[model samples]
Target: MTKLLFLVADGMGDWPVAELGGRTPLEAAPTPNMDALARRCVAGTARTVPQGMAPGSDVANMSLMGFDPAAHHTGRGPIEAAAQGLELDPDDLVWRLNLVRVAGHGPGDAMLDYSSGHIDTGRSTPLVEDLQAHLGDAVFSFVPGIQYRHLLVQRGGARAPEAALDIRPPHDITGQPQGPDLERFASSPRLAELRRAAARRLEAPANTTQANAIWPWGQGRPLLLPAFRQTFGLRGAVVSAVDLVRGLGRASGMEVAEVPGATGLLDTNYQGKVDAALEFLARGGDFVFLHVEAPDECGHSGVTADKVEAVRRFDERIVGPVVRALQGEDAALLLTCDHFTPLARRTHTPDPVPFLLHHPRLADHALPAFSEAGAAATGLTLERGHDLLPHVLERLRG
Candidate 1:
């Protein structure tokens, strides 16, 4: 029997009614299919990790993929670097820099639009290519994102773990959170000079990215771990439109299954994703990792209606096909978010995410469709996210 299908929506933060103008996008949205599945399936809130921890891509993803974030965690740069085929030596220091636009001059109001003025690949790609040419060997390469974010892979060899280079992350409504141990690393005089050099190169007029300058952040290296399949004893493949999810698949020693023209939009190839999942099943995959980026994108832009529509589209286009495939099959199914990315908050939230498990022989309960409000009432209440994998494994073993 096949294991299960794991569908994750990354950076899905939570917001209260007042904060979101009387409805969090997930609560306000019409997710008829998801709600229905939740009613009959095991469902409830699950914490991805502890609150007030450093908001990180790798840590969150590690938890979602059924690994302990504390033991298996690494930096986001290593994952992206691996995904892009950049092999790194153990001595190299890497940072994942987002090329964002910086507005205003002074200290506070300087960083513009956290996302580099909502960059598109067309306008931003050339600038990224040009910067690599001018900077030469000191700087490595930049990977344009499926979303507006860009990846800057630096060439820091032989630098001590406590070097002076610092990351300038986005998030200052209250105050910028310091990265774990990065400040101390940035304190050394030699490392500080290197940091200054990197900053100068980024700020220099000679470089023209057309999306403003880069805001370097999330500095760390690879945290190696056993492959997910090896640890869990399940064969899996990841199907995603976004590069980061695909990158995660690569890190976990899984195939990055492609869905043609999957644009990460509500109007993207939804049917195409469904087809991809079926294809993965045909190719002998016991588990499939799927990701949709639209809801998170709309939340980041604070577009409530749009985010709701994205959720609905996932229901009609993606969920239905997956459910249909499960009919009469031995395969089980699981769906949940990586984290909350509320429209009002415009960032990843620490709140528990709603999750569901569906199988043919499970108890009869009717979840109308997928929505935050209904999920609260679903019979299955999980206390933590890590519980999901073992539970699914047990169900599969049955």
Candidate 2:
């Protein structure tokens, strides 16, 4: 039995940075371990985000798991709701709610911070709980998650008139003027009043976090995924800090490992996540999807140095140890990122990201390093991101 490790450094794909000699963060970062692995694996690129779809981590990682997003995607909220193990009715429309800090929202508004400075879960948790207590009756209830990420479910929301409004993701509009999002929220009397009520509570003098507002978007019905063991004949475990990844695992009937201190940020628990994945595999799990969100968070911050350091950490802490631990085992490691969160745009792009599938038994060992440039140089580009998993599975079979 070949143990499979699907390692993902989320949003590590990037465009060339002028400050870093026109090399992407992946190239600028010192990925000695990834470079060494690339020498043995067939280096190539995979388009993780399908064309015409928003390059959210949800969509990209779904593809990485070999599930076509076009078929399985419901929305970001339902996926995260699954992470919480919340049983939802078919008509329940869950919306991803963020504890945002905004100064203005009436006439001229500013999105002071999309994540409310990535508010600590300690502070953000209580605030959301308060909202639930105050506003949650039957139709709307708040669900707390890590950091600023949370959820709001509307009982039978699909039939609500507000469901047709054009909502947007908060991260994509950071440091920008709040536009139709406010008007759309006002269009719904209940949500508009809820927004006002939430502000009074969140902005109270007792509240410390900058989270004075609640931004809700990415609403959809419950998501259903086929069992991984049934679809692929493999018992898989997913290790991730974000609920989005764990939600997918839960929906797919895979084991989801929750590691302590595994914040989806630069300062996350890398060693803890690695131990969880390795332990899962040691105890009869056939595959583990270890995802690191630090690189993606850094990419969203638009700080090139932070992203470079994040990539380096991924290479040193994640890639090096996992490969070394599986030295004597019959294992195959598929290394890749979900999508490109280019610093230039400060958002995800529908561009091809690099990937490498390596097995110790393979004889093809020619590439020197794994990077966006190096992968492109190999001239092997996969059109659909979902195919990358099947390609790696073939290596395990061989």
Which candidate number maximizes lDDT? 2
What does candidate 1 score in Cα RMSD to the true structure?
Answer: 3.9
Model 2, range 339-388, lDDT digits (tens) per residue? 99999988788889888878877745467778888888888888998888
- Per-prediction TM-score, please? 0.84, 0.97
Model 1 lDDT per residue over 1-398, tens place: 66588877655445765744676666666667666676677666676775545555455666777767666555666666666666776656556656555553234444546656555566666655655665536545555554455566555642654323444446332132334323443465544444445455556576555345455555556546569788788888888876656767787898887777777666678787778878888888888888887777676767677777787777767787888777878877787877787766767676677777777667445666655555667656555566668777776576
Error of 1 at 139 (Å): 6.5
Model 2: number of clashes?
A: 0
- How many residue pairs of model 1 clash at the backbone? 25
Cα RMSD to native, each candidate?
3.9, 1.3
